[model samples]
Target chain A: MTLQILLNLVIGMVWMLLHDEWNMLTFTIGYLIGMIFIFALRRFFPGRFYGIKIWSIIKLLLLFNIELVKSSLVVIGQITRPKLNIQPGIFKLETKLKSDWEIIMLTNMLALTPGSAVLEIAPKEGIMYIHAMDVAEFKQSIVRTKDLFEEAIIEVMR
Target chain B: MNVSAIIEIIVAVMVLAGTVLSLLSSLGFIRLPDIYTRSHAATKSVTLGILFILLGTFIYFWFMHGLISIRLLLGILFVFLTAPVAGHLVIRSAYRSGVKLSDTSVKDELRDDLKKMKQLEQYHSKEG
Candidate 1:
């Protein structure tokens, strides 16, 4: 839904019309070709960015899906098991990520991964307080999850 | 034996599997203990289930139909973009309104830390 992709879609539709074939197949082909044209003409335009990092978005999405599955499994396992052995706690995490948007994204990532919820964020102070269902090995989870998501997010946003 | 048939099989499998995941998410939603844990069920599993379902649908149109359905792709992005934010908002609002953590929860490090900070603030106010 980025602006550039919207432009690309228009260009693709135009391309289909010009070719005298308005079928889905022709439209798709035109879209890919339009994308290539935009990529090739990037030097001339000097626009801030075309917002066409399709590959990067795909990779980021895959990372998200994998994390979602892994964490969902962990939480479900804890929930449905014979014996409940969870050490639930709320902990303050110091995040190097600055900006309200970045903090919001990070908090959402925390909520979506594992059984952790972002209770509050002190954005100016660069800290987020998170509540987790399983805090038995809290440090390890924090390290592994923060590193994975933070790295991926920085890359994707960049 | 053709490539398209194989692709169709893969797509079918993705769709079926995604449905199963969605089902599990709902099951978890009802079965989880409390609001805090229930939020976990609602957020993680449901979002992922939606992702897989969208992925399957996207591929079905893209590969099988030989037509890139950018709209479906956009729908996937929309879900991905919003799901977590909504989840975070729900939990944040709950905490802000003092929706209690489950009774079985062992520790509340934040509450203790906040109380200590408040005590320190009072002492500093007295000194000043």
Candidate 2:
């Protein structure tokens, strides 16, 4: 828990730096306020941490960026052509991940990627509905993306 | 126009265009028929729009302050990384919820394959 708070602070610092807005006093005050809010929310929700391994999260982040660049180019190409050739469709992807945080992370990752959207999550069936730009090849992509994300996520959460 | 003024103007135009595109995309999301179409609107429009806005910010910071440029780059990198994954998950959830396509859908290969497989199973059971 202490480590998580430290990590959040580091992330916030990085964010502040990127935006070129930094004040030491503001950072400290905001950090404490954020910590308080987090703890208070956690108490109300009463959920367990999935025990994320830092290395696994790093791996996921790396994989996510690589895919993001590739997908962004693909989307750009599709949009720039004289004739649009999008075959959009929804696909159900099964997951072995049982934790809410893991699922949320997976969903967020999908949403961040280009040409894909997470429409719904059915926890009862452990299934995620994803929209792919190229629905014709959705089965393959769905399996590939879900497997890649779920494996890394489950490993981290373990 | 001076170089700085020209750059500023360009950035301003880009930001305006991006905002307009983003608004149009959100409107499409609301107007679209199905989850798949809505996802298309949300993903494509917002991604491009945000990219433009960030680009404007990057240019503005680069010309005006010339500090913390790396951070702006990282911000772009983070947004570039995360937007598509969110769209994928939304589509995934919609599919798992049994969201149906519109009647005008021309081709549904997935449904066709499922139907074919069911027929095959029925035929095999009858043979047994």
Candidate 3:
């Protein structure tokens, strides 16, 4: 990260000299250029392509937005309807993820999803207490969450 | 109309859509039955709404003015990082304090686990 920032700064400075304007937009463009350079140089560095990880992370973020939009609309539907039949419950989610950081990221992602929040996480047990808005569809949600977010995060972490 | 005029119109529409989503979030906050679900409204919609607004602003500044606002970029990143964490903290505290689940709630697995722990503690105390 530090290396990337240092390289970006040098490129930004060079861009300012070329453009005759030392403003933010030029620097941002330079940063993008520097990032592309670094990404292209990934083969030379060897082992763990941070650029690929960032790409996967961006994909994860896009997936998050899709889930967010769908869930928000679902919750809005629930809110608007007269017959509210929400079956809110807290259930234990045991994840196969080993590291603390991975677990934290998973929990946070779950919190941001449509119908769930992490109430507590017991690392010793490798379980998180997730509160859900609707329990019936939770099985599906859990499967989808694991398939979408967890799988991508594992790729990003690796 | 010119190309710049069309861009301005697009920017205005994005900003308006963002504002409307935020208003819906507030309505959900007020209209939702319980704290747990309300936190969803507070976190998800608000985050997306602000993101839309920021994207519009980013386009306007970057394309029209030929300058980027570092602060705006930072604002988008800051919100993405902190909003969900803040909402999580709020609900976590509420649950820890023994806030009852909504009337519609079916079961609480944690409370059962707490009860089992308490029972184990009583048994150990008796032996000691």
Candidate 4:
């Protein structure tokens, strides 16, 4: 645990330095303070330090970027065209994911994707109500989207 | 513009775009009629906006320092993990609290399930 704290501090400093936004002293101080908060709450949390599954998270980041790029183009195209061709609707998706962390990950991913938003999630029933700007396309694609992203979350967190 | 100046401009543009998107999403939060609609704005728009900001940061760091540190990656990771969870909690709470939808809302399967459950409860009570 102490080692993890030290590692986090070191990593934080490197991050601050790389960004070239904050001075070294400020970064170090902030890093120390942040680590203290993490250390203090370490035992209260479960699953890898801070409850993050690292490799799975990396995969998610990659997937998110890909989706973002794809959605950006789609959205930009829609904006440029004359007609505002959107079929907006809210749909309920049944998710098999159980943990709070997993559900959160899934919704965030959904929200980030172009033309979709996670309106509400009922964790007790594993249901998520999502609004899609292009509901017709989403309906056709949702199963694949959930299978890809939500399944990854289930594997990582559960 | 010099290479550094151009990079800075690009980063600034990205940041500004992200900020605008975030604000728009917040507006959606307020303007959207129902809890479900509001949540949609809050979650999706915010996530995309944040991603843009992070991407800008990542690019700025890569250009300025010549190396991609794990820390920025971690920040991205943290946002990705927490944003959805927060959305989920809000939605779940809304559902449990009995927030109703607009009349135009079609095909409420969850409501149907709840109705079936109530009927089952009544039947069991009569038998008992």
What interface RMSD does every candidate have?
A: 1.9, 4.9, 1.3, 4.3
Q: What are the clashing pairs of model 1? A: none
TM agreement with the true structure for every prediction? 0.72, 0.52, 0.80, 0.57
Give the per-residue lDDT of model 2 (tens digit) for A36-99: 5555556544343313355567898888767655555555555555565556665667788888
**Model 4 / residue A108 / CA error / Å:** 4.8
Worst 10 residues of 2 chain B by lDDT: B104-113
TM-score ranking, best first: 3, 1, 4, 2
TM-score quality measure for candidate 2: 0.52
Clashes of 2: 42
Best-matching candidate per lDDT: 3
Which regions of candidate 1 fall more than 4 Å away from where they truly are?
Answer: A1-62, A82-84, A155-158, B112-128
Tens-place lDDT per residue, model 4, A127-154, is 8766665567666565567778976777
Q: What is the lDDT of candidate 1?
A: 0.74
Clash number for candidate 3: 0
- Best candidate (score: DockQ): 3
Q: Higher-lDDT candidate among 1 and 3?
A: 3
DockQ winner, 1 or 3: 3
- The 10-residue segment with the lowest total lDDT in model 1 chain A: A45-54
Assess each model's interface with DockQ, reporting 2 decimals per model: 0.49, 0.20, 0.59, 0.19
Worst 10 residues of 3 chain A by lDDT: A42-51
Worst 10 residues of 4 chain A by lDDT: A72-81
| Clash count per candidate | 0, 42, 0, 2
Candidate number of the best TM-score = 3
Ranked candidates, highest DockQ first: 3, 1, 2, 4
